[model samples]
Target: MDHAPALVVCLTTVSDEKQAEALARTLLQERVAACVQVDAPIRSFYCWDGKDCVDRELRLVIKTTRERATALQQTILRCHPYDQPQVVILDCSGADPGYAHWVGENTTED
Candidate 1:
């Protein structure tokens, strides 16, 4: 059986749930992401501007193809309210064939 091309799952954190939902909606509407899942009230610990900090955040898991990854990142950066948004692209494997195909179909330019 032939497998579809791999998908990229990008992760980004936002200050609140509202931002998370807005970002997810924009990405889906723009076709930059096939699907986006938002989870909130996550505690993140990181160093910023030479200071260590811990804060509550919402995480957005964005799914798309490698072809759309760059554009997706740019879109997230532009819409995000953070000076340095955490946009991590994860290489995905072993996805269900139908789901993978669906993602590709949705994320491609019309």
Candidate 2:
């Protein structure tokens, strides 16, 4: 059995590649995320407010630790362009220890 300590994976989507890049860069620059992978555009179907909507959005896969979760969410909210941006985090305690350790190491301040 392997434990990842406080490792977590966060998911968020943006309207465009530029926004995706901005968000990823900010998180890395602030040391709140070890890595942010920008995925190709995905078609999203959901209800916003009172209307049904469908959109092509770019997803960002953020890797970090629970210790940096708050900062990660705050930074996303501060930088995201959506009226209600998606900031979802999932515990990754079952991940490979070595990979999880790498994420923790890169996200911590020097």
Candidate 3:
């Protein structure tokens, strides 16, 4: 049996590739995230100020340790342009041993 520390999987959508790249670069530069995958030109629909809104956005998937989740979220919130940024964190129970090791090695010291 193998027990490894949990990984935090966060998802947020941005307005464009520039925004997505900026966020990813900042997170990686600060070592807040091991890696960030960006999916651009996504269609999103949600409620805002009691009104429904639809827009094209880019989605960012950030990978980090559970210990860094709070800090990562705080950074995103502070840097995000939206009044209410869509930041969601999910827990990764298990991952490939090699990949997990790589993630741990790349991330900041926890």
Candidate 4:
């Protein structure tokens, strides 16, 4: 809907399920994310420090508000195991009105 709340979608990868759970919980507890969906056993290919790398990872799909997106990202960076964790933020415009409202309501900061 054109009148939908301003939502934010973020993506990040964790090395394992424990880490995925911890980070997800932190984001939610901090009121930075309304929802965090974890998908596991995904193959990731990349290069770090000029070395080719391939590994299995869990991907977290995070839903938040534009206002809380920064806090969510900051929390991920602070709590993530990797020195450089992947944190991607996307705009969520024109979403279903009910869903957008839920995300906004759930992510309000204290």
Candidate 5:
């Protein structure tokens, strides 16, 4: 097991399950994400354009490394259906050592 100090998790919302799966597959295929957890039928309430809005969406939890973050963001933007997609990154202080190692090694360059 290889230990790394930090990992990166990307959270993004998709219009539907299919879109979520597609994005996940693309990221995995491109080795931009080691894994992606998809949660669908999520109820989202937020303010947009100074108005409160609610919608159903699917969320993708992408597991990767800090090195892959910028590229991952770009790919998500390219494939996302929304004009302005929500792609947020979380810094992880610890995780499964082997899994983290895999994530660090898998991603590609910009």
Candidate 6:
């Protein structure tokens, strides 16, 4: 099956579940993301400033098309409380045709 050209899955880690849910709702309300799945707490190890740290964070899995990526990211930045939020975009291929079409249809064209 042919997948949507711009289809993508965006990932981000939030400080807590509350923040994750709020971000998800805002993205959906703004029509920037077709769906947002909030995952359980995850242990993350990274360096910040000059120190290494470990944190418990909630993960947000966002589904949208590349056309809406910029807008989606902007929304996240605007709503995110963290100084530097993790926003990773992953290209998607071989997706279920119906689901891919749904994502495209739900998100804004630009």
> What clash pairs does model 2 have?
none
Instruction: Give the per-residue lDDT digits (tens) of candidate 1, residues 47-110.
Output: 9999999999988889999889999999998999999899999989888989999999899887
Off by over 4 Å in 3: 1-3
lDDT of 3 by residue, 1-110 (tens): 35555788999989988889889998888777999999757899998889999999999999988878988998899888888899999989767767766677777664
Model 1 scores what on Cα lDDT?
0.91
Of 1 and 6, the candidate ahead on TM-score is 1
lDDT of candidate 4 over 1-110, digit per residue (tens): 35557888999999999999999898889888999999858999999999999999999999988888888989888889999999999997787789988898898877
TM-score, model 2 to reference: 0.91
Determine the backbone clash count of candidate 4. 0
Candidate 2 — number of clashing residue pairs?
0
Candidate 4 structure, TM-score to reference: 0.93
For each candidate, give its TM-score against the true structure.
Answer: 0.93, 0.91, 0.91, 0.93, 0.88, 0.91
Candidate 4 Cα errors over 4 Å, as ranges: 1-3
lDDT string for model 5 (36-103, tens) is 99985799999999999999998899988888888889899998889899999998875878777767
Any residue pairs clashing in model 3, and if so which? none
Listing every candidate in turn, what is its Cα RMSD in Å to the true structure after a full C-alpha superposition? Answer: 1.4, 2.2, 2.0, 1.8, 2.0, 2.0
Ten-residue region with minimum lDDT total, candidate 3: 101-110
Show the lowest summed lDDT stretch of 10 residues, model 1.
Answer: 1-10
| C-alpha local distance difference test of each model | 0.91, 0.90, 0.86, 0.90, 0.86, 0.89
Which has the greatest lDDT?
A: 1
Candidate 1 TM-score to native: 0.93
